[model samples]
Target: MNEVQTIDELVISFENHLRSLQRSRFTIRQYWQTWKPLKIFISANNIEFFDITVGKQFIKSKLGAYEYANLNQMQRRLVNTVDALSVFQQTGKIHFGSAPLRRNPPKVFTGEIGILMEGYINFRKTTFGLAKSTANNNIRSLYTLFLFLEDKGVQKIDDISEVYILFFIKNLNPSTLSVNHSTLGVVKGFLKYAYEEKVFSTDWSKIIQRTNYKGQPKLPSFFSTDEIKSILNSIDRSNSSGKRDYAMILLAIKLGMRVSDIAGLKFEDIDWDKHVLTFTQFKTKKSITLPLLPEIGNAIIDYLKYARAVSDESHCFLQQLSPYKKVTAEDVSRVARFYIHRSGISLKERKHGAHALRHSFASELLGNKTSLPVISEALGHGHTSSTMFYLRIDINQLRQCALDVSLVPSTFYQQKGGFVS
Candidate 1:
């Protein structure tokens, strides 16, 4: 094979490799599209051979040039593209790691403590069958605890004391209620495991005070009917991107599918003759079959027939650009936000993303006098309580359910005169 001399050649080679791997057209297109900026930057700066160092410098230079929303997206895309390129240059094949951890592992998780943490993570996965995200979270919490233990001059797992655990809790950021709760729960579990395994003679977990962080439930954000209509109408359906986005928004509002489910949708998931969409939900891992609304079906058909890029990948949705691949949940959110921004709809403290569409779907059903259980089923929620949050936004229904306080008679004593019943 000829030596890959330019970024264009490298991209072409990578695109072919992705195609061979049956990667979605959208994925290939997005990867290539993101690489275009780096290609340009390299040409302008006379930089040859793209690597981590050059990628960082390029990112640093372009930090403030883009809008806040696009800046993070661009940075992530660029970093991922550069990393892929670096790997491909070394192996002459496309290989990437799993999703990056939300927070970097603390320094203390490097030595003996690290080994213990790894064992705990494996135990969480194999023994308890916890999800990958949950296991990673537990690992993160343990890492934090280990960092605290290190600071206290405590060397091993056996040396852990209640005072050190209490000190860790005391030093936790007060504003981070969610983090503190998760960390404390994970620490408790760790202590229990250590005790059972005979690593610690005493189980200190039982003594660690629980962080009382039962925050008041806030109302979920949702768009009104008019707002949803306005946002949907804002999409310029004349273009390929418009058609794809319109279909995605319709799925969110009509079917109440999560962004991940939408992004992961495949051709086989849709039953055209039966007029049903069936797929496993991303988060809940439950198979759900939703009636395919005629409008949604038609929108999808229009995109698939005319707008969708040609690719062997089975995913229904693909990026319109070159090297097309399956869209991500983040991509779905960006599409929603793009239209919401253009439509001039004020989210008003509600989440301003595709999830908001789901919220709106439940709210609409509730407004139409739909039962909570039915609404929960439609939303693919495992429990009705998961759907209860929507009730907080249903003002009319709440009013109807409100109890008459005046019916309860209260005996009172007159202030200046005499006792009155």
Candidate 2:
């Protein structure tokens, strides 16, 4: 019999309706944000009772300022809000949807794309044992494809036909440049995962074909020997900050440790008498050991003796500035990038963060004839195949491994034919 008291109260009621419908947190949040602008318009006009004529006037006025995209989104929110209000009015909770308009059919999208992404996350967790960050990236890749499909007027899970998927992959226009083979792989992988999980009716993956437009595999960029030396030389070791940066770079390049793992290392992880630095990799969750190279040992000793911030925490790396908390992955990468610029190198080339140094280290070792298994162990790669990507970079090693062939017979045959002259 009584209407909602205030705008805030009305919003709360709407939010509660959404929650009761079992909508996702993301959807509920979007709905709330979308409805907020309308509330603002209502309050501004002093037309407060969920009136349709006033709503239409407010939307018409927006046509002057709001672009097509904004208008479409607002319309969608309006539709959902009106629908919810109608439900509430039916229950005698509020007078709602007094203004009636023909509603458009919900657009079709390959919404099963979400199911595929969830499948990838589950697969990475149960099968590959990937770290949270890596698993997250695979999900993001699949999500991006759905966004592309949504832009192309395909919306809803059931709308994703084989033709829809193939056209999306192979026949992308220049403006829709985001869709590529890597994303195609994501779509492909998601479909396979769905089939395996029995989420698809007919193993939709079998019909999904690849266009085979492979991207050029790039060598991971790293500081060359001279660049590394230049960076080290640029540091004023007398300063505490310089000493810590020097030490961090040494660990990054020499030990091939990821910034995340390096930042998480504790003072206790180092064994002085045993001459080893032992720590579990944060990304891989595997324990690894490095023979404390005298240079690395000296760097750590210098940093701890002078540069390291004294703290109750035992992490080897600590924030240089305030709080004296643990260094983050971004912090480690930032320092490395700063030194790179200070070294007077062009930032124009593919800029490398701290992990590039890890890639650099792997490359260096593989170039020096270290076996793939050894490099994998050093890099804390759970699989040797993962480390095998470095082979693509070590061309010299590949050349040297070419079986020795005598050129003498060929030369003599050429001379015997007298063609050499």
Candidate 3:
């Protein structure tokens, strides 16, 4: 049989394997999707799985086509192909497959970081049960670090010295990218974790200290109470999508959840009787339970009962169009952006996107004199320092405590050249 027929057989056999493993229908479909490209790429090249060198060559050729941003996705698909080949080999489903992909573990220098990344990826997949975007983010960060190390001529975990980290930090431009303190913190955390775990003995933390410059702190762009009212008013909730959009926007504002968390929400995540919503945070690898406030619960209930589309998909949010599927992270951002524009907000502030609603929630809480720890927990942040960022944006609360005084005192008015001048 030709390549197409061979691929079909492979897919059939893989589906059987997946079914045997008790994989969900959605996941089985994703596996087929991941496999199709590899089969097509191989067929076009007139190669069989037994020719491991050809597969390796094809992977290398395609590597250049993917830019830095897309390499992780391409790599994942390639990895999956390797996994499928392994399954075929073990099950006697295909005789020509060699499973050339070694699945080399990751570390700091000697490809150990790849192993480090895989640990995080597996944790996200199994423990936290994060959605694809979050797992992708955590994986991407580790991959980027590996790429950085490769560029620096550090090929093993032991090679990652304090000097190398210092150089990386010093060379990073925080202003243009707007990723100064946050990037530093991520790197510091990773290194510290690695060091303390004895994955690497080097004290990279001492060299890659947090910058004292403070850089330009980003003021979290959140809607003021009045602005929130105006934005909500702009939503035309008579239509189905309007109702759904309104519900989503309201949910974020009221609960202080990330857009990723909202998009990944399922029906089972919410508890009506207990007035609670529970889910695992993808970023921090922690399970969280939040009390479903009356307003949020009511909004979601209304949407599910009236506005939500009928679909087999378990996700709470779905696309408005036919063959409706789960709403993506991009969809969340786009919907929020559209309304932000409609509300006559500045374009500069629109970059905050759906996340601004969460920030708005935190700001409002801080304004109400809520403790930082409380706000941090509500926002699912691992540290209070992260939530403290919103405290600066609570200008209304600050105004209440400020001592109002005339700038020009009577004593200063008498001496024109003394103080006023």
C-alpha RMSD by candidate, in order = 12.5, 13.4, 13.0
TM-score for each candidate, following the candidate numbering: 0.67, 0.61, 0.54
lDDT (tens digit, per residue) of candidate 1 on 237-354: 9999999999999999988888899999999999989999999887777889999999999999999898999999899899877799999888999998899889988766778888
Q: Put down candidate 3 lDDT per residue, 1-421, tens digits, no spaces.
A: 2232355565676678768878799877776665666677878877655334444555555542122223355465665465555446445443333343534334332366667656645754787677675555555455556666676778777777877777776655433243445555656667776777788777576666655655436676778888788778888988889888887888787887777778888988988889899998655657899989887787777788898887889989999998898988788888887887798755564455887888788878877877666777888877765555545535565454344576866776677666655
Worst 10 residues of 2 by lDDT: 62-71
Error of 3 at 3 (Å): 32
Global lDDT scores for all candidate models: 0.76, 0.68, 0.68
Whose TM-score is higher: candidate 1's or candidate 3's? 1
Q: Which digits, one per residue and each the tens of the lDDT, describe model 2 over residues 212-331?
A: 553336656766777778777877889888888888888998888888877888989999999998998888788999888999999989999998887888898888887889988888
- Best candidate (score: lDDT): 1
| Candidate 2 positional error at 292, Å | 1.2
* Clashes (N, CA, C under 3 Å) per candidate: 12, 6, 12
**Order by TM-score, highest first:** 1, 2, 3
Ten residues in sequence with the least summed lDDT for candidate 3: 62-71
